[model samples]
Target: MRKLIIGITGASGACYGIRALQMLREIEDVQTHLVISPSGMRTALEEGTGLSGEDIRALADVCHHHKDIGASIASGSFRADGMLVAPCSIKTLSGIAHCYADDLMTRAADVCLKERRRVVLMVRETPLHAGHITLMDQATRSGAIIMPPVPGFYTQPKTIEDLVTQTVGRALDLFDIDHPSVRRWKKECATEA
Candidate 1:
């Protein structure tokens, strides 16, 4: 089984985390370990993730507390296939960049790096500065994929749900997990022609 860790940080776009979890739930081969940062919890409440922590826990095959640094997911020996921090905030990004394992989320990210597992950071921020770029560069150097949640115009999405699905689908693709939300680009059908 592919053991995956999905961390929800306190980024403005809480929907991405929720959507990612929803997608992960469909993969039979994937066993997920979920951890939500304190700030993410507040964001989840503010934005209303539409599901409670318990609800999320049930969606995931395995869940871990964010503050539980002693959790098995926090150890490199646990052998996670990858870790994804969707809606990763600037603070959390910097924390991971500096190897600040103050919490289980960061610790698990650190473990992902040390263990050479794929770590995808879905950062949701704009108006970047030098510090943000530097932190991102540092994390990438340490073997983390920084995927900013910048929506594209090519798809010409008609609804917020479309945009969310595309982003979440892309994240899942990184881990080779199949999600139906994403519309894989294909040539126009004869009906459209």
Candidate 2:
């Protein structure tokens, strides 16, 4: 099975993390291991994901406690194909860049880097300062892919949902998922038959 580790931090846009989990669950070939920050749980509930271990379980194959550094996903020997930190907060980004594995999410990211596997940071922040930009740079220099949740409008998306799907689709593309997660505007099709 193709395994991926996903981390959700207590960032403002919980929808991104929830949507990513939902989409990952739809991939039969992908087995997901999840870790959620304590704040993430609150955000998930407040943002209407219903917030419980069961909710996390329904989204991913396995859910590890935030403090469980001893989890299988924390070891390079487990050999995951990649790690995704969806809706990653700036704090989480800083922690991961500095190798501060105080939480399972950061530790899992650290493990992926050490194992030379893909690490995608769906960093959810805007109007970033130089320090924030530097953290992203350090992570990329360490072989991690820095992906912010910035969406595009060339497609003239009819709804906000469409916008969200586009970002998720692009993220999935980085992992090279065989499935198309969202629709793209084909020039010919946009012009009609």
| C-alpha root-mean-square deviation, each candidate | 2.8, 2.9
Score each candidate by Cα lDDT: 0.86, 0.84
TM-score of 1: 0.91
> In model 2, which runs have C-alpha deviations exceeding 4 angstroms?
49-53, 185-193
lDDT of 1: 0.86
Stretches of candidate 1 off by over 4 Å are 187-193
* Candidate number of the best lDDT: 1
lDDT for model 2, on a 0 to 1 scale? 0.84
Worst window of 10 by summed lDDT in candidate 1? 184-193
- Per-residue CA lDDT of model 2 for 59-99, tens digit only, reads 88888998998999888889798998888999999988898
